[model samples]
Target: MSSATTYESTSSGHMCDMDRTPIRHAEAIAARNERDEVYAKEAKARELLRITKRKAEKTKLALRIAEDKVYKYRQALFLSWTVLGVYFVFSTVFGGHGHMQLHLP
Candidate 1:
């Protein structure tokens, strides 16, 4: 005739007659906490994904700029070398260096 949970022990110090309502309540509380943990992790995962996308975009743009700069520098170096070669050839043929000359007959 009692509404409260009770536990009885035997002579060997082991539990005997015990009520199960408290056990079920404890299991339910644990399950609810586990469900809440999943929700919390979902929000954290979304934030991490967003940050990763931003970093990838920045890295992609930096790589493109670096490639463009290298191409321009390489082209300019080739042009400078070509101009120097032409100047040397003209100087030799016109007697500017006095090493060689062209005579017209």
Candidate 2:
């Protein structure tokens, strides 16, 4: 997909050769195109890897957040149970009546 413009010397019956070597022939263009295709594939693979890594990171973050929530819930449950036990102990020691009270609003 490239255009090459060459000027011919009419007086000398010669042509200016900008790319004269065998390595710089039409085959070189095909080789360059093949190389570009390979490079494109490699770039695509790298992009996919980055996306996969990001997904894994997000999953890990979500798991950590969930663990923290569960830990907090357990701590709260333990604290409430301890408070209930303390209340029961104080009532028994003070000889409180064994009557239950419920308040509704």
Candidate 3:
């Protein structure tokens, strides 16, 4: 038997036989390389997905903060409008009071 026709026992109680041509080994190596490349692409995709998810979460949090700010300022906005309306009314009613005031004759 040639050196190329070697046999070894595997840990799983199986026999690893290397017989015939050396092209089989080359083919196996190529297959393994292809698998590794696929795994690398999968890892990169997962990393990108993680980054996108984080960005989405940040955007959602920012939106929530903005919503909370709007909610917190709701009363202030209403109060400002109310004050403006009251000022307009008061100015209309009392604007002539100052102009009509006369000095003692």
Candidate 4:
């Protein structure tokens, strides 16, 4: 009888431990899943940030190129106007018969 009682008690204890094992395993798996989800979100955010930064850099470069083109065009226009003005002055003063000649009778 004593041996039988000992055996029953040992079996019940083992059964209880067995019942708790699966619950513990489930909790651990849930915690790991949560951690993996957080890591995935962080990775996605980093990728988005990198893409945005690259676009901003491209835009800045494009703006600089446009500004450089505008500066060159303005310089060319100013040079053309100056040349035209000089040509007009020379033609008016020296073209055809001399306008400033003195006639001594």
Best candidate per lDDT, number? 1
The best candidate by TM-score is: 1
Q: Evaluate model 2: give its lDDT.
A: 0.82
Off by over 4 Å in 1: 2-19, 98-105
* Backbone clash total, candidate 4: 0
Q: Model 4 misses residue 18 by how many Å? A: 4.9
User: Which residue pairs in candidate 1 collide?
Assistant: none
User: What TM-score number comes out for model 2?
Assistant: 0.59
In what order do the candidates fall by lDDT, top score first?
1, 4, 3, 2
Each prediction's TM-score versus the true structure:
0.66, 0.59, 0.61, 0.65
Q: What is candidate 1's TM-score against the reference?
A: 0.66
lDDT of 3: 0.82
Per-residue lDDT over 28-105 for candidate 1, one digit per residue giving the tens place of the 0 to 100 score: 999999999998999899999999999999999999999999999999999999999999989978878765556669
Q: What lDDT is reached at residue 74 by model 2?
A: 100
List lDDT for all candidates, in order: 0.84, 0.82, 0.82, 0.83
Q: What is the lDDT of residue 59 in candidate 1?
A: 100
Give Cα distance to truth, residue 38, candidate 4, Å: 1.3
Across 1-105, the per-residue lDDT of candidate 4 in tens digits comes to 554333343544553355566799999999999999999999999999999999999999999999999999999999999998887788687873476678999
Clashing pairs in 2: none
